[model samples]
Target: MDLVGKVAYITGGSKGIGYGVAKKLLQAGMKVAISGRTLETVQQAAEKLGKTDKVLAIASDVSKHGDEKKAVAQILAKWGTLDVVLANAGVGHFAPIDEMSDAQWHAMINTNLNGVFHTLKASVEALKKSKGYYISLASLAGTNFFANGAGYNATKFGVVGFTQAAMLDLRQYDIKVSTIMPGSVATHFNDHEPSPEDAWKIQPEDIGDLVLNLLHMNPRTLPSKIEVRPTRPDKK
Candidate 1:
C-alpha cells in the first residue's frame, strides 16, 4: 500500500512500540492520530515528534466503548478518512493463577483483548471504504506458556486467534489484517524499565520497520502472522 497521504489511527501511541510505529508512519508521509489514556503524555509525545500538523493526539481508554467512539470521531473530524488502525494498547499482569487478583486478570483481559475489539469495531467502516489494514500487537507469550504469565498469555492467545479470524473475515472487503508477536522488546512494558541488559532484545523501531514492511507487501500475498524475537537471548 502507498503510505504517502494515508491516514492511520494508532492506539497507545504515547510511548513504547506504538510511539515508534507512529514516528515511522509520520516519516513515511502518513497523517496519524495517536490515542492514549493520558492526554498529557500523548500531547507531549506529539510535540516531541515535531509534526503536530500531521499528528493528532487524543486521550482515550481503549477498554471503554465510549472512549473508543470518541477517539474515532476525533480522528474522522481531523482527517476525514482513516486508512489504517493499529490496536497496540495493552497492559500486562504477571502472576500465578492462584495468586492473581481479580483486578489483575480483568485488567489484562480488558486492555489486551477487548481493547482490540473496540478499536477495530470503531474503525471498520472507514477501513472497509479504504481497503485498509488492521494490525494487532500480540506477544510471543500468545503461543508459549510460562509460569506466572497466565493472565497475559490468555489475552495474547485470544488476540492471535482474533486477528487471524478477522483477516479472513475482512479480506473479502479488501482490508488486510495481521498480528505481530514479538519477544523481549526493549520497552517499559509491565512497568519494567529498559536497561543495557535489554540490548539483546528487539528494539521498538524494529517492530516499526516490520509494520512498514507488512504494509508494503504485495496485496496478493498477506503475511498474516509474524513472530519476532531477539537473535541472541541472554544466557543465565
Candidate 2:
C-alpha cells in the first residue's frame, strides 16, 4: 500500500508505543487520528506531536464500544477513509490468580481483550471499504505464561487468539490483520516511568519501526503474528 496520504487510527495514542507509531506514520505522510480516554490528554499529545494539519485527537475509552464507534465516526468524518487501525489501548494488572481482585481482573479483560474487539468492530467496515490493515498490540505474555502475571497473561492471550481468528475472517475482504507481541518495552505501563536505565529494554520507536515495516510489506505476504524481544536481555 502507498502509505502517503493514507489514514490511520491508533488507540491509547497519548504516549508510549502508540505515540511512537503515530510519529512514524506522520513521517511517512499518512494522516493520523489518536484516541485516548481524555480529550485533553489526547489533544495535548497531538500538540506534542506537532503535525497540526495531519493529526486528529479524539477522546475515547476502548473498553466502551460506544466510545470506539464515536471515534471511528469522527475519523471517517475527518479523513473520509480509514486505511489502518491499531488496537493498542490496553491495561495490565499483575497478581497471582489467587490474590487478584475482581476489579483488577475485569479491568484487564475489558481494556486489553474486549477493547481490541471493540476497535475492530467499530472500524471493520471502513477497513473493508479501504482494504486496509488492522493490528493489535498484544504481549509476549500471550504465549509465555509467568508468575504474577495471570490477569495480564489471560488478556494478552485472548488478544492473540482473537486477532489470529479475525485475520482469517477478514482476509476474504482484503483487510489485513495481525498481532504484535513484545517483551519488556520501556513505557509508562503499570505506572512505571521510562528512564535511561531502561536502555536494555526495547524502546518505543523500535516497535514503531516494526509497525512501519509491516505497513510497507507486500500484500502477498502477511506476518500474522510477530514476537519481538530485546536483543540483549542479559544486559539487565
Candidate 3:
C-alpha cells in the first residue's frame, strides 16, 4: 500500500513500541494520531516527535470502549479516513497464579486483552471503508509459559489468539490483520529501564522498521503473525 498521506491511529503511543511505530509512520508521510492514558504524556511525546499538523496526540484509555470510540471519531473528523490501526496499548503484571492478586490479573486482562478488542471494534468500520490494516503488538509470552508470569501470559495469549481469528474473519473485507510478538525489547515495560548495557535487546526502532516493512508488503500476501527476538543474550 502507498504509505504517503495514509491515516493511522496508534493506541498507547506515548512511548515504547507504539511511539516507535508512530515515528516511523510519520516519516513515511502518514498523518498519525497517538494516544496515551494522560493528555500530558501524549502531548509531550507529540512535541518530542516535532509538533506539526501531520501528528495528533490524544488522551485515551483503550480499556474503555468509549475512549476508543472517541479516539477513532476524532481521527476521522480530522482525516476523514483511517487506513491503519495499531492496537499497541498494553500493561504487564506478572505473578504466579497462586500468588497473583485480583488487581494484577484484572489489570493485565483489561489493558492487554480487552484493550485490543475495544480498539479494533472502534476502528473496524473505518477500516472496512478503507480496507486497511489492523496490527496488534503482542509478545512471545503469548506462546511461552513462564514461571511467575501467569497474568501476563494469559493476556498475551489471548491477544495472539484473538488477532489470528480476527485475521481470518476480516480477510473477507480485505482488511489485513496481524500480530507482532516481540521478545526482550528494550523499553520501559515491566518497570525496566533501558540502558546502554541492554544493547543485546531488540530496540524499539527495530520494531518500527518491521512495521514499515509489513505496510509495504505485497497486497496479495498477508504475514499474519510475526515473532521477533534479540539476536543475542546479554553476556554476564
Computed on alpha carbons, the lDDT of every model, listed in order, comes to 0.93, 0.95, 0.93
Residue lDDT tens for model 2, 1-236: 89999999999999999998999899999999999999999999999999899999999999999999999999999989999999999898887889999999999999999999999999999999999999999999999999999999999999999999999999999999999999989999989999989999998889889999999999999999999999988452
Clash pairs of candidate 3?
none
Candidate 3 C-alpha lDDT tens digits along 54-115: 99998899999999999999999998999999999989877678999999889989999999
Q: lDDT, candidate 2, residue 208?
A: 87
Estimate the lDDT of model 1.
0.93
Q: List the residue pairs that clash in candidate 1.
A: none
- Model 1 lDDT tens row, 22-122: 99999999998998999999999999878889999999999998899999889889888899999999999887899999999999899999999999998
Number of the top-ranking candidate, with lDDT as the measure = 2
Q: Please give the clash total of every predicted structure, in order.
A: 0, 0, 0
**Alpha-carbon RMSD of each model:** 0.8, 0.8, 0.8
What TM-score would you give candidate 1 relative to the actual structure? 0.98
